[model samples]
Each structure stands twice: as C-alpha cells, then as structure tokens.
Target chain A: MKPTSKFGVLILVAPAVFIYAFAVLLPFVGTIALSFARWNGFGTPEFAGFDNYIRAFHDTVFVSSFGHMLFYIATTLVVEVAMGLLLAGVISSGRFMGYPRVALFIPVMLPMVVIAVLWGAVFNPDFGAMNAFLSAIGREDWRQVWLGNPATALPAISLVSGWIFAGFYMAIFNAAFARLPQDVIESARLDGANERTLFWRIKVPMIRQVSSVAMLLCITGGIQGFDLFYVMTNGGPYNSTEVPTTYMVKAVFRDMEIGFGSSLSVILTIVGLVIAIFFRKWRSTRQEDVEY
Target chain B: MRIDPKKLRRLLVSVVMTMSVALTSACGSSSEEGDKTLRIAFGSNGSDGQKVWDQAAAKFEADNPGWKVEFQVQNDDLYQTVGLQNLLTSNNAPDVYFEWAGARLVNKVNAGYAADITDLVSSSGLDQQFAEGAFGTTSVDGKVYMVPFTSDVTNVIWYNKDMFAEKGLSAPTTWAEFLTLCEKLKSEGVTPLAVGNKDLWVAGNWIGHLISRSAGESVYDKVMSKQMPMNSPEFVKGLTYLTDLQKGGYVNASANTIPDNEGYNLFLQGSAAMLPIGSWLIGIAQEQAPDINLGWFNLPAIDGGAGSQESIMGVTTGYIVNAKSTKQDKAVEFLKDAFSADLVGAWNAAGFTVVAKSADAGTLDPVTQSMVDLLNSGASIVAPPDTGYDLKMADALNTAIAQVLDGVKTPQEALDEAQAKVETQ
Candidate 1:
C-alpha cells in the first residue's frame, strides 16, 4: 500500500517538475555556462573563466547603474507603499469624499505604455500642460527642463513610474483590507481606540503577511525595471538613468558582446536571489498575530 | 463510496494527454510557400525608396519566369537590433537589409555575419561607380562589405534664404563671423540656430563638426578613438563654442526640450535664421513647408584653424547581404543588377543624392541638387565621429556630450571622465 501511494504521488507531480526544469532550470544553467566565456554570439565561445566577472566589477557605468537602481528602489518603496496604504485605509473607512472606490481605481486599469505616452505629452516642455500651468501662476521662472536636465531627469521618470504603479498597489491593499476580520476592529472601537491606534494595533499587524508579499513583488519588479526608463530616457544624460537590465541589453544587442551580457544577467539573478532570501527570512521571523 | 484511485489517476492522465495533443496539433500547421514569393525587409520611412525598389524588383521578376517579390516592411525600432541579432545567431539572416555604415555594420563583418562581395563589386564594375569617400565607410580590413546607396552630407547649414535677406545677413564663412551673425540675429529677437539638442545625437552633430573643423581631421579621429582625451583643448573648444552660443541667447531658450520636428518647424516659420543639419533637411523642408525659400552651405571653419575651409562630415546608407545565406550568389547578383546606374538615377529622382560616378547618375530636387553640388565642391569630407570610434567609445562620447549640455559636468570634467571610461574599455 505504501509503495502504491508513493508511485501515485510521483505520477501526480512529475509533469509539473518536467515543465519547470525545461522552461526555467535548463535556460538558467545555459546562461551560467555562457557567462564564463568570451563570445559575440556569432562565433565559437572562447573559455575565459572569471574574466567577464572581473571586467564587470571594473565597469564604471555598470557600478553607477546599480547604485542608481538602489536609489530608485528606495524612493519607489517609500512613495508607492505609503500612498497605497493611505489610499486603501481612506477608502476602507468609508469616509472618503465624493467618488466611489471603483472610480478611483480606474487608473490601474490602463496599460502602462498608454499611461507613459499620456505622461510624455504632459511633460513636453513647450506645449505640455505642465509648463502651461507653471506659466499661468506667473511663476514662469519655475518652468523646468524636466526630462532634459540630468539632475531632474531620473526623479521625473521615477515620479511617472510611481504614479502608474501606485494605484495597482492600492487595489492590492484594498483587497487585503477587506479580508481582515471585522470583530477585531469592532472590539478596538469599543475600547475607545482612536483611528490611529486601531490602525496600528489591529489592522497593521493583521496585514503583515500581505504587506511582506507586496514588498517582495515591488522589490523584484523594481530591480528589473527597464521599460519605463527605456521609453523615457534610454539611459540618457550620460547614463544617469541606466539600470542593469538596460545595460545588459545594450551590451548584448547593440554592442554584440553576448557573453559579457550573460555575465551581467547572472549578476542580476544573484542580486535578486539575495534580496528574495533576505525578505523571506524577515517575513519568517515576524510571527503572525492573527488567530483563525 | 470513493472511486478507485487507479481509475481516477488514469482519468487525469488521459485528460492531460488529450490537452497535450490538442496543443501540439494547434501549433503544427504551416502556411503554403509560394514559388513566386521573394521576401524583402526594410526600415520605416522608406516608402518612397520602396516604391522604386518595388518597381525594379517587379521588373526583375517579370523578366524571370515564375518569380515575384514580396516586400515586408518593418519599423526600425529597437526590435531591428534584436531581430538582426537573432537572425545572425541562427544563420537565417535576410537576403538584403539596410544598415548604418560604420561600427554598426563593422561588428557584423568582423563576426563574418556579412557576405564578402569583392567579386560582386569588381566583376560588376561598381567599385569605380561610387565616389572614393562614399565606399570608405562600408569597408572593413581593406574589404568592401556593403554597396553605397544614399549620401548624407552632415555639415551643411540650411538657412531660410528669404529670412536671411530680410535680416541683411549672409552665410558666415568662419566661426567668429558665425558668432557675430548669431549675436545680430539674437539682438533682433530672432533665434539664431534652430537646434534640437534633446535627442543628444542632434547636439552630437554640432559638437562633432566643431571639433573636426577646429582641431583638424586627424585630431578628431584620435579624440573619437579615445587616444586623445575628450578634455583636450580641441574638445574643450568645441564645448565652449556651443556653451557660449547658449549663454549669448543665440539658441532657442528651450532648445534642450524642443524635439527635432519642433525645431525644424521653428526654422520653417522663419523664427530661427539657421539650422546646421544634414542635407536630408531639404527633403523635410519641402515636405513640411514648400513655400520657405531654403538654401544650404558648408559649416564654416574656426578662424585661422588648421582645418580646411570646406571640410564637411559625410555618411552613407548602404546594403549588406547575409554571410550564411544559401542563396548568396543569387543575392549578390540581385544587388549588382539592382544598384546599377538606372536604379541609382531613380534614387536621385526621388530626392536621394547617389554617389554613383556614372555620368548620367540622376537629378534631385533643385534645392537638394544645389546642396549636392556644394557637397561635391567641398575640399575635404570627414567621417562622422561614430565611424572612427569603436562601439563602446562612441556611446561614451555621445552620453558625455549630453551630460555637459545639462551642466552635470563641465566640458573638461565630462571629457576627462569619458576618456577614463573609454581607456578602460
């Protein structure tokens, strides 16, 4: 009976295991092997173990680009998560003015590329509504070279990205908030708890699991951000806005250094693994306060 | 009451097998290949050129029994790079494709991704058809890798002839004279140069010409190759020239934010006096505002500089065939026949200036013809900066110029940093 059960279990799991190995594991192993070679994607790869890594370490653009990614992640985490939580709390309380929650969440339904194009028009220096508003207040001096100046370009791009993704996070938080037990909130209210205390003591701790999951998603996506920057800047103004993904792409496709680009990809994967592991550990250590 | 485990398991297995079979069947069908079909892929904005090529291709197919050509147009977005890479890797590259003529093509040649057409050029006698400098761009290691199709004269300064006459200004012949003219135009409340520095490449053209003419040709090449530091006196002079123009209020106040079309629009409206751009601007001017009286001249040299007075930057658009193609012989024959004087003449008729040395090459629009004449009369023609530098160094220089314009770094600092970066590469 035990042998039959074991065989049954293996049969049930084998197909999924095969699919995962073929789709993910094999390509990953190939990438790792390719990272140690010198290839231009057309000729035979010459073995140059660790040379790609050594060169990557010395590359100033790649180093600076990684630093920029961290800076972007930091800013995005604070702004997006805070905005999402605040908006979710407000809508969940049923005291928000005017619009329905569904109406407020409509921006999340639009595609990111569409949103980017709309914002591109709005940010145009000459005929864009942004500069028009600046001039309207007789503060024409404040009109900025928003996307053109190096100092402001990255921040401006980040603002657009935050705006696009904040609503999606807000919807996630809203759904999570709806699943929280109402009895706990009611008990807190009966004990003369203010809104802040109720939120901190009851709601926040209850949603910790969801929050951690959301954070993990944000970190992974943030690390892999390419489209927004690619569309807006293409890492312009002296590669100030470059991310690792864009750098890897330029190296592989534009420069035709396939092996070097593969090495960069491996570095990116390692960085992602470190972050995921750290987050998992943190989540595990934080005990769940909710009892079913 | 529960069903037997083996029966349930078999039922699930059968369902999975059915789904797999269905998916495989869905993906298995192939479209019928037609014998007459000849696939041609080209970049966007080639409709006019495509019309001529389609006519020629149609003629060729008609002459040959049971043959037709199918044109496949693809936008030259970032995907072109990806598609080309994939094709080269798989040894399934297109028969003929339009490619930029410098480091962009050199990499393909170095990897043996492009077919050697030495026989095609010599046997077909096209080696002597194109101008001497026109073929230099597509040559790698003393072997010609592509056939020149169109000429891009980069240092031409296009001006509104009527606007210049109204402002009592003549085209300047020296850098100092140009600055004086700029100051005069600015004092009269007109933008002096309609430049779109937002694209970075537009700014690069100005910077490249100034550096080439200011420091002379060889120094420009050295700077581009990173042998000379970007912070060298020559580069600094180029940056200072642009910065001074900005400070003097000679350029559009929002030049960095205005796109190429908007700047060109301003020029067309006569709000700006001059536009330093390629000869391609004549086509744009005709398309956008045909009523505007436009004229072109070579970019002026620095006063008392080592550079010749008539030095201009030149580029070419050309064709390259796939090295691994089984039909390489047929492809070579097609290119040789298609790029003859007749086709070259058709291109010239469609506003392109062909480099073919045939006496009956063709004619362009009157204004464009004049610009081509001016290009023909130039004392020297310098290759664009990217043509001289390797891929990495070219990107580094282009990016550094943007940083300098945005004031993130001083001209010296930007050049020094770029130099440091490129040297390491």
Candidate 2:
C-alpha cells in the first residue's frame, strides 16, 4: 500500500480508536489506578501502594470466594461441555430425538435471573417440587435443603447455571457438526467404523477449535459469575457460595471499601488475561496448516 | 472524487436530527422542579408502613396548598445495603429520609452530611415530649441530627400462647426457668426458639437481648461505646449463653439457613414455641397468624448476672434532613408539621409509637401501648455493639457471628477475631 493511502487508513481509524479509548480504556485505567488507593467511594482517596492488594491477599473471604469460583468453573465446565457435546453429536446424527433438542435449548433463551428464581422455588425446603418428588418415592428422609446448606449451595447454583448455558454450547457444537464434511462420515461408515469410533476419531478431532472456543467462553464467564450467585444466595449461608465478583461488590458497595474492591477486580482481570493468553498460545500451536 | 450533494445533504440532515432528538430528550428530563416540592427517600417498610406513609403524605399535601411531597420508597437491599451511603454523599440525596440510628447515622453526621436538629428539637419542645432514649440516638457531640419516628422494643419474647398452653407452660421470669422451659419445649418435639441468622441482624437481635440480660444495661452501654472489649468476661458470657442455647437444641439447628420470614413462619405455624424478636413482631403476628394467640415478655435476668429484667435493646428509626438540602427551611417546616399534635395522634392511631408529645400512648395498639409503657417506666435501653463500632467493624462482627452460628468457629474465636478487626479499624 502507498504511504498516503496508509495515512488515509490511519485517519479513518482515528474516530474508532478515540471511541475505544474514551469508553473502555479510560475506565480500565481508572480502575487500575484506584486499586492502589484507599477510597470509600464517598471521600477523597488516599494513596496506599499495594495496601489494597495486601488486604485482598489476607482476606479469608476473598480466598473462599476464589475457591468457590474454581469449584463452580470446574463443575460447570465438566457438566456443560460434556453434556453439550454428547447432545450435539446425537442431535446432529439424525437420532431418535426430534423436538427434544429444541426443548432442551429453551432454557438458554430465558434470562439467568429468571432461571435462578425458578430453581430457588424448585429447591424450597418446605414445599418444593424436589421435596414433593422425594416424598412420593418413599425417600422423604433423603430430601435436602438444596440452596440453604453450605455443602450443596454452590453445586445447586452451578447446576442452574449449567442448565441455562449448556443449550447455547450445544447449539454451537451442533452448528459446527453440520459444517463437517459428509464424505468423511460416509466413508467412515462404509469402512464399518462404529458409531463411537466415528464420533471419537473423526467428529471430535474435527471440532477441536469449536471446543476450545467454548471452553474459553466458559472459563471467562465462570470467573465472573455474579448475578446467579447474587440472586440465589447473595454469597450466604455464610458466604459459602461467594465468587470474586460478589466479594468485590460486597466490599466496594456494601462495605464501602472501593479500593480493595478495585484490587480484586484487577486480580480477576489479570487471571482472565492469563487464561486467554494461554489458550490463544495453545490454540495457535495446535493449529494444522490445511490447504483447501 | 464526485460526491452526490443530495446524499451528502440527507446524511447531514439525519445526523442533525439524531443529535437534536438526543438533546431534546436530555433537556426534557433535566427540567427543574418547583421550590415547594420536597423529595424524600426511605427504605420500603412493607405494605402496612407504606399505607401509613402514603396517608401521611397525602394529609401533608392536602394541608399545605402549594407544597408537594414526593415519597420514594425502595427495598432494604437498595436503602440499607450500600445505595443509601451513596445517596448521602451525592447531590441527589433526599431532603428528608429514614435511616438506621446509632453508628450508621453517626458516620454520616460526622462526615457532615446530616443537618443538626438540636435547635429544632429544643425550640419545637420535642425534647420534653419524646422518650428519654429517643433523643439519645440522634444526639452526637452535643448536637441532635435526627428525629425519632418510632421506637422498637427489642427484648420482647413473642411466644405462641396456644403452644405454651398445650405444653402446660408459662412465661419464665428468671434465667433458670427460661432454660427449663426451653428444655421442656425441646423435649416436647418443638424447637424452643425459632431464631434466624440468615440476615445476620436477625441473630444480632437475640444476641443483643442476651447480652442485655447477662451483662446488664450499663455494661452493654460501655461495650457498645467501645469502652469495654468485646472479648471481656461479660460479653463472653453472653456469647457462651447463646452457644449453649444452640447446643441445647433450644434454637433451630437449621435456623442459620432460615431467613426472618421463614423463621417467623415456623413460630406462626406452631412448629416453634418462641420467637425473641422486636415488638414489631406483634404486628407481623397479628397480620400473618391472628389466631396464633401470642404473648410477649421482657428478657429475663441471668441468675449470677448484674443485669435486671427491666433492661432491653431499644433503637429508634428516624428521619434526617440532608445538610446540603436546597430547601432546608421547608424540610424543617415539613418535619415540624409532620410531628405536630394531630399528625402524631394520627401516627399513634395507625399503630406506631411515635416519638412526639402529642402521640396519645393510650390510643396505640395494645402491644405498642405496652411497649411504650415499658419504655416510659424506666426500662434501661441498650444499643447493639455495632451501634458503637465503625461500619467495617460492625459488618465484620455481624458476619463473624453468622459464621459462629453456622459452627464454622466458636464464639470466643469469632469474638477474638472480631475484636482484632474492631481495634484495627
């Protein structure tokens, strides 16, 4: 390209760059700066280099919140991805299922807060559908306080979250499966490649990129899980279901510790960036140079 | 390059139109209000309080021809959680609003956000009319910052009279008898106390009452003021009593998971024998379970404690004007009119124990009347420990207490850690 044309392109991109800087970059920089100060969101902030970070380090609540996020992310990744992939494979292969896939995907279309409230009702200790079902099956003693018990609160919330998002992942994998070459599948079938082998050897390997993308989305979303936990538990039964974002909100807004809250947000941002970078590198290294 | 002038003109016209629309909408929304309009924001106090406030506002507006009152009521999540502090600091704070008394208001007052109402109270002769402790909560550093609206009697042991009768029980007047009653109630397959620690404050109510009983009102006052350590022997003994209540199965094992409504429901449904909550529970009991046959008594004294049975936990919810209010004169006028003899009488008629000289104590609900009598008859009132500590210290202590109730930590361990936090803060 000519130098004058390059200059013209740069001039054309100037407005977009300005918009990004004002809208996104400014807030990002402000948050980072605030992380190093002691602010109560009401008065003048005092500079306290690394003090907020040190407080975050010592805060047992923050540590517990991190553990909660990890548990939620791991359980959600395992359940949603595996179930999504299996269901996507089955639905794409012209199985016995007809409207079942559509029915399953309905949850993905609903708002997460609605899903949380619905699940909360279903898990009600006294008069819940789950308890009713248990009583009908002669297992009344097995009925559990699903959202109230610290032992089961996180898992129950994770299950609701997974149910809400799994359908989206399933739809993604299903679309990816549709774009796969039919000839390879036909040839594999002709060669007596069993159903399991076809899925494992051909379909799975082909959709590695889609799975990687899905996993990345899951990781980022899981790390920032706030609304579901907030609506369902508010990180209670004694902060047992707390996540990083919830903890940050409680500190910044509830306790008026804006500085410490910002530090937590910075930590979350760094962890998210590291994961994204690691995944990008792994993706690039694993990519095959295919000529079509 | 050749440009189509028509297309260029059209694009320019569209952009101009969009900008104009945006500017117009902004201006339309930004229009200023009349000077007579007084906007107040308060936490939503359920349907009953809403009705009473609505009636009062209507009456206020009707009496004042040109003045208008705009009442904004939201959930506790919005008002009590964090949004209230934000509102107080911002230019958008209400002219007058209800706030939790004690250290919560003290923080705002010390920050110079609330107006001093000392002159108003004195000139208006409210000091003589209101209860003794009513002026105490809003007074800080010799200046009054708020007007007490209603007093909450916090040591009331609301019990199901039907359940007590069925179990052949009577109200216990001493600590030993209270424990004996609890044991008997528990052995009879009823949860002795339908206590809920879900919101932390619900549990704090019980703990504060226990402290008042075990440590005496003076010790509670000193502890709340931070003159005594939280881990002091008296305070520790109070917590020990609470832990024993938990261990003895007097409290619901799952109470930590139950919210206030659910815990109240248990007591209402006869699943629990007692619920030691505020006198406000009387209204709730009347509304939810009118036929439950309820009775209340002050918390009994411990055998070897210095406290008297007359001591109780009492805090008043009141209104404060914004220090930066443009209509400060009008706000004070509204307060004066609102707390007038007729208005206070109206409030008394509406079941509230209003802190006004004009409030006819005899006209209050039977329960509220009794509570007023209790307050007037020289019952010692103690504020919660959090009423003295800073915001961070208070929240940390409340959360730690919740954890203790969940069996995550012993009372001593929790108090020790909480003490360290309070001292640091």
iRMSD, per candidate, in listed order: 3.4, 5.1
In the range A1-292, model 2's lDDT, one tens digit per residue, is 3444444455456657868997999989999999999987766889989988887877777777889998998998977887788888888878846688888799988888888778877877766798889999999788887776889889999898878888888999999888988998899999999888988888988888889889889988999888888877888876788899988887887677788889999998998789789878988798683321
Recovered fraction of real interface contacts per model = 0.41, 0.25
- Best of the candidates, DockQ: 1
Deviation of model 1 at B379, angstroms: 3.1
lDDT of 1 by residue, A202-248 (tens): 77778887888778878888899987777666676568788999899
**What does each candidate score in C-alpha RMSD?**
4.3, 4.1
DockQ score of the complex predicted as candidate 1:
0.35
The stretch of ten residues in a row with the least summed lDDT in candidate 1 chain A is A1-10
Residue B11 lDDT in model 1? Answer: 77
Candidate 2, clashing residue pairs? none
First chain TM-score, candidate 1: 0.89
List DockQ, one per candidate, in order: 0.35, 0.32
Poorest lDDT segment (10 consecutive residues) of candidate 2 chain B: B385-394
